[model samples]
Target: MTTLTRARTGPFAADYAALKAAAWLTPARERAWERLQEAASPSERRGNERWKYTDVRPLTSVPYRLAHAGALPGLAEVKKIAPWDDAWTTLTFVDGHFAPALSTEPTGRVAAGRLATATASVQSLLEARLAKVQAIDEEYFTLLNTAFLSDGAYVHVPDNAVEERAVHLLFIASPATSPRVAHPRTLVIAGKNSQSKFVESYVSLADSDQHFSNAVTEFFLDDGAQVEHYRILAENEKSHHIGNTRVHHMANSRFNSISFAIGPAIGRNDHHALIDGPGAETNLSGLYMTTNGQHMDNNISVNHEKPHGTSRQYYKGILAGKSRAVFSGIVVVKPGADKTFADQKDLNLLLSPGAEVDTKPSLEIFADDVKCFHGATAGHVDLDTLYYMRSRGIGLEAATQMLIRGFAAEVVERIKLPALARYVEGVTEKMLPEFRLEVPK
Candidate 1:
């Protein structure tokens, strides 16, 4: 593994000593901490090529104390924020500590709990596959999360098992006296010929609270496995949110992911996938809505390491006020990976004059017999559409909101979880009023 010697030792380093002593440190975790300590800081902060558009300096500079054991005093606040109305089994974590008080027991063909409570069989599965998809040298935030990794959702489905309801993992950040940070690490394993769905949500108790959330999740799909994953980011507007999700696909497996970024003053969500075997298929989709002084960035990359693999990426963003948004999509086809098919597209709707978006869609193809394409677009709502709606007795605000929602619906509709999809649509509708229709002159 490569190391970054120039990486700045940030706030995480300050709490490293206290954090390691409290948790039952394993050799793997110790190695990860060393990697983070040695790795260079986020290159994007230095105005580097990968993170040039989105500025995260303000977030990285804050000194946030890491959350420890018994952080959640009660479950009253968590129940209100987490979606527990349905029958889905929920594994709740408060301030990165698994809260059994607010979670439901896994009762089906699935095993779900904190890593500590994992059965021997489940532990074996996790030990064999936990960090295989995400490398420690790739990103600063990823390495940071792995170093402090303690209790998080660990889910496993046996071969040929099919789950009826989606498993929900809720990571709720409570108000802290001072600035605080939480690293929520989740590992999901789908056995061969198995199928399941998962919904992972990050939310704050109130909008006034200020905190930072650094989360990382990994998904392993064996041959003939199918998994649908949803990541919902609804943190407080005063908080900073950074998350990384890595997925590995085996032969004849399918993985679909939908990420919604609707909160946080400064947010960055990354979705990366590695197609390790032939006949694997993946669909990566995202929706980001930012308003006021918010800044949101969505980064996605899909690597095809085997022949006959297919992947697609679709990301859309809505920006209002002086908010800034970024969409970077990179698809790489390795040499001799013939018969690979990939497509990438990004669309942005700017609702204010000061709103900005930087989009980059690139495809690297080393094989001649591959079909790859990428495209991006950023602009305001169509004046003609607004005019037509006004002529039909619809008000300007309503008209603009409709158009913006329509743009985001394209991606939201693809989510396989019905309840989650509906909830997201409702949230998007409520967010529409934040933007106004200014007919372009």
Candidate 2:
């Protein structure tokens, strides 16, 4: 394995000084920068368990510039791609910088804007909940996200406000004059008895040049609040994407998170949620599809600190060509978390001989009277099922594609949003091989 080296006085180090001098430094930002300085050095990837299956040597070997203001020119065509209809409030950021001209105004009792220009109360809420769920320790990618955080999404729903429509945040990465990187941060604070929906999408407008996107999001749900969060990643295949999300649930709060990943040459997502008070509930579901030489990693963990908490996690992946996928999940029930119920399942389907996947699911229970279970499975499509379909006059190749679709449809069906689920199905359809198979023209 080849080792990568990074220059000490590279773009990141230079950005640190420039940001500090430009008054972009906050107490929290300063703390994060100091932490990154200590841990962001280039080193051998063999020792880190997180980097075992994924080779990130290219990250340090290349020196990419940081995204700057007005780096992307004004383009009208690039502003038309939105995940949701006009019924939903949408916020769009180009190259990690908030684009007000392309975003829709919010309605009702919702505070949605850029984190850097958010209200004082919203900033206070972020400060109180940013790292409260998952601390930054030994996670170099997350620390890097914190250190370079500039402008991203910030939303707050006040108490008793039930938002009828979902809030959409779209982050689009465009090719710069040179290879560049963007650190986008999102913070959401849901007050007591509040209910809302959030959708986050990371995409690219350009097709060719290599870019890197490092993003982090934090969600704080007060008691009795309910929020459904959806994340979609479909960057350019030549780009690199790393995303982290930390969710904190208070007593009786409910959090539902669903994610889909389909692009990027190398992509990794780390998600963690904490049940701080009693009776909190969480449901996490995800799907990742890769083809050709792409590689993806999804790491998730949930900690139950109070009793009567329930969590269910299920993730599925479809690998084709020589692509590789990794899924690792952990559920922990701490002491005094009696009556906690947790179930986790990870399943992967390999369509090609060269496709590969690594799945690991774990449960740690330190409390008595808790119900916990975890299981992981990786294998090719069921031969028997395919045979039965082929016997019914369906071509073998088409039958195999149908079986793969059914395997992934299980997770897609779990998505409550109808349009989103259909969008995922469409993406899945396009991802499969278009074989004539004597079945379709």
Candidate 3:
């Protein structure tokens, strides 16, 4: 196995070289990196399937510098941005390195800590399920993360253990320097009959300082376990974010994921969920709000590999200014996965004439007995509705804002945690101003 010991010194060296130098690189990851180095740069045109709508030139233009391990965020500053209101445990990371003094150990049935400092027992558990949930071959960034993963959070909920408060993992990206990159990896394991909720948020300190956050989150749920995972990406507008989340559900298990992307100059999120056992259920929802010159993309897939599994996915985007948005969703039912139920929908509301949105929802089923459906819609807010609201004593801007809020209410209400739901509402309210929606007094 080839291990990465230090940051690369040259400008010509690929980003993978820096990654390889930052962490322990297994033989598999090394080989994957080699392939990435040889692969040709993707074309910027809209003909390519993966890069159909979003342009990749900005990401490929600059070679990102590795975030210095010495400039991690302070605990006092991180606490200010913590989004949830739970007495639950907390794990803090600065520039992708774990800060032990800033984080809280798990209480009762929950176990959370830094992966680099985890004991042999915890390491064994992680080793058993790390690469089992999702494949990292397709995307170069994921392969880079696998090749150079060093310090991040590790959480494990034992069998039948249920926590009253949600566990929070706040990843703080404070770049003391410019044009830096950090890869934060989180592994969450929910044991059989266990229940837990985890909230992961990414925030940056400065808007002009260019930073890249490439994060990967893996969730493994044992038989009959239930897990609700929420991810919020609200970084500076000048930053770039590339994130991938993989979820695996076992027999009779349930997994729910809600991801909100409200910031970043350019962001691409890939979500994958696998129903590996019978009677498993999965619910995936996402919301992306983009304004100005920002660009955001979301690609997701759900695989029903076993019989009698249920899956639902819905994604919505509100695009304003000249910003661009893309959403691609796919649901696949394999053979013998009979009686499986799957549905997917993607909707986009273009708030500006120049704003653009590209949405595609697909269903691929090999089983004849399965019920699967997919749909996509893109349009502007209803002028008639806005006019009606304005005539009923509401200002034009406030009326338009009310309609947009109502459009997102379905997905926001689907959030099971009351406190978290309200927090998300507040974030949505803050986003209205960017979309030119007036705040009603």
User: What does candidate 3's lDDT look like per residue over 1-441, in tens digits?
Assistant: 222222222342454454533233255456655555544344335345766777766865667766766755566665445475647577878788777666776788898888777788787788777655677555656656665666678889999998766788777778546587888888899999999989888888765688888888889989999998888898888888888898898999998888888889989888988999999999999888899999999989889999999998889898888899888888889998899999998888888888888888888889878888888899887777787888899988787788789888878887877767777888789878789632223
Segments in model 2 whose C-alpha atoms lie over 4 Å from true places? 1-10, 20-25, 40-43, 71-82, 434-441
True lDDT of residue 329, candidate 1:
88
Screening candidate 1 with a backbone cut-off below 3 angstroms (N, C-alpha, C), the clashing residue pairs are 7-40, 7-41
Candidate 3, pairs of clashing residues: 4-20
Q: Candidate 1: where is the Cα deviation over 4 Å?
A: 1-5, 20-25, 43-47, 69-80, 438-441
Stretches of candidate 3 off by over 4 Å are 1-32, 38-47, 70-76, 437-441
lDDT (CA) per prediction = 0.82, 0.79, 0.79
* Model 1 poorest ten-residue lDDT run: 19-28
Q: Best candidate, TM-score-wise?
A: 1
TM-score of each: 0.94, 0.91, 0.90
Using TM-score as the yardstick, the better of models 1 and 3 is: 1
If ranked by TM-score, best first, what sequence of candidates would result?
1, 2, 3
RMSD per candidate (Å) reads 2.4, 3.8, 4.8
